[model samples]
Target: MISEFRSFIAKGNVVDLAVGIIIGGAFTGIVNSLVNDVVMPFVGVIVGGIDFSNYFLPLTSAVTADTLEAARAQGAVFAYGKFITVIINFLILAWIIFLMVKGVNRIRAMEEKKPAEASPAPPPADVQLLTEIRDLLKTRA
Candidate 1:
């Protein structure tokens, strides 16, 4: 059982999965930063400087809350902005991953498309015939 477990852990797929997970985590951070720091700011500027993360409504008409927290405190069913934020982040992450994978596949396809270099021709036909004749003569002797 221990040997089986060790073998499983040592498998190429396992190592690949581990590496992928680590890289994915790092990529997640990058995507998050891109969404929060770069994309969201631009989106806000284009949309009249309104913060998407702050756009929400208070469910309770009597209890008007200025912020999401205030709305939540007043028991309002708010959009929470976090949901949309996460959606945008996920879209961005997926797009980046798709592009990277596409680029890698393109490179792999190019490599595969290249014809293999031809090896040097074998010994001349006359040489082969002579060798065969010499072998036959020796066998007869």
Candidate 2:
């Protein structure tokens, strides 16, 4: 059972999955930063400085705390703006993944279409004769 577990862990699929999970986690951080630090700010400026992260509907009178975190701390609040930002992040990530998958598929298709290695041509007559001579000498020895 231990050997089987080791074999499973050593498999290419497991290694690839681990690597993918690590990379995906890192990618999430990058996407979050892109949305929160760059895109959202730019969008806010473009849309007359209306910050989406701060935009939320108060479900209760006590939820008037200006920011999502504060509103959540106070009372129930509909944090739709944060949801919108998350949706945008997901779209961007999905689009990038789609593009990457498409490129990989295209490369795979091209490779599949390429001609296979041609069989090596037979050695020249003189080389073949030399090889035969060498083999004969070895047999005689």
Candidate 3:
């Protein structure tokens, strides 16, 4: 059973999946940083410096706090700005993955289109030598 488990774990597909998961986790952090630190700042500058993180709707009259965190502490609040940021992050990540898959598919297609190596030609025939050898063998027999 342990040997079977080891074999399953050692399979190429399993290892590849594990590697992909690890890389995806790291990539998520990079995308999040790109959205929050880089993209959002530029967007804010373009839109007159309005911070989207603070944009929310108060569900209750008691939720009058300016920040989402403060509003949440006071009462129920709908945090749409955070949702918007998350949507942007998802779009960026999806686009990157799509481009990567497209590139891989293109490379695979190019490889498939390449012509196979030609097989070597057979050696030239020697009819006279073959006949002489057959005659000599017949005489011996």
Candidate 4:
């Protein structure tokens, strides 16, 4: 059973999956940073400098707070602004993945479009025998 487990871990697919998971985690962090640090700032500027992260509605009158964090601390709050930011992040990440898949597909299409190299046809058996006989005769001469 241990040997089976070892073999399973040793398989190329498992290794590839592990590598992909690690890369995906790293890529997620990059995407999150791009959304939060870079993109959101520009978006905020365009949308009258209203910070989306702070946008929230307190569920209860007692939970009156200006910011999402403060509202959450007070009571349950509907954090729609944070949701919007997350939605935007998802959209950007999805768009990037779509572009990457499209590029790979385009490359695959180009490869498929290339004409295959045609191999030269072999001479007929009679012609081959005649050629061999001629070579023998030439050697004798």
User: lDDT per prediction?
Assistant: 0.87, 0.92, 0.93, 0.94
Candidate 4 per-residue lDDT over residues 1-141, each given as its tens digit: 999999999999999999999999999999999999999999999989978999888888889778787888899888999999999999999999999999999999999999988888999999999999999999999
Per-residue C-alpha lDDT of model 3 across residues 1-141, encoded as one tens digit per residue: 999999999999999999999999999999999999999998899999978899999998988798999999999888999998999899999999999999999999999999988887754578667888899999999
- Residue by residue across 1-141, what tens digits does model 1's lDDT show? 999999999999999999999998998999899999999999889979978776786677765777777767777656757678889999998888799999999999999999999988889999999999999999999
**Candidate 3 global CA lDDT score:** 0.93
- Per-residue lDDT, model 4, residue 52, is 95
lDDT per residue, candidate 2, 25-140, as tens digits?
Answer: 99999989988998888888998998888778999887768788999999988888988899989988899899999999999999999999999999999999999999999999
Among these predictions, the greatest lDDT belongs to 4
Candidate 1 vs candidate 2: the TM-score winner is: 1
Q: Any runs in candidate 1 off by more than 4 Å, and if so which?
A: 57-65, 69-77, 130-141
- Estimate the overall C-alpha local distance difference test score of candidate 2: 0.92
Q: TM-score for each prediction?
A: 0.78, 0.75, 0.76, 0.76
Error of 2 at 24 (Å): 0.3
For each candidate, how many residue pairs have backbone atoms clashing (under 3 Å)?
0, 0, 0, 0
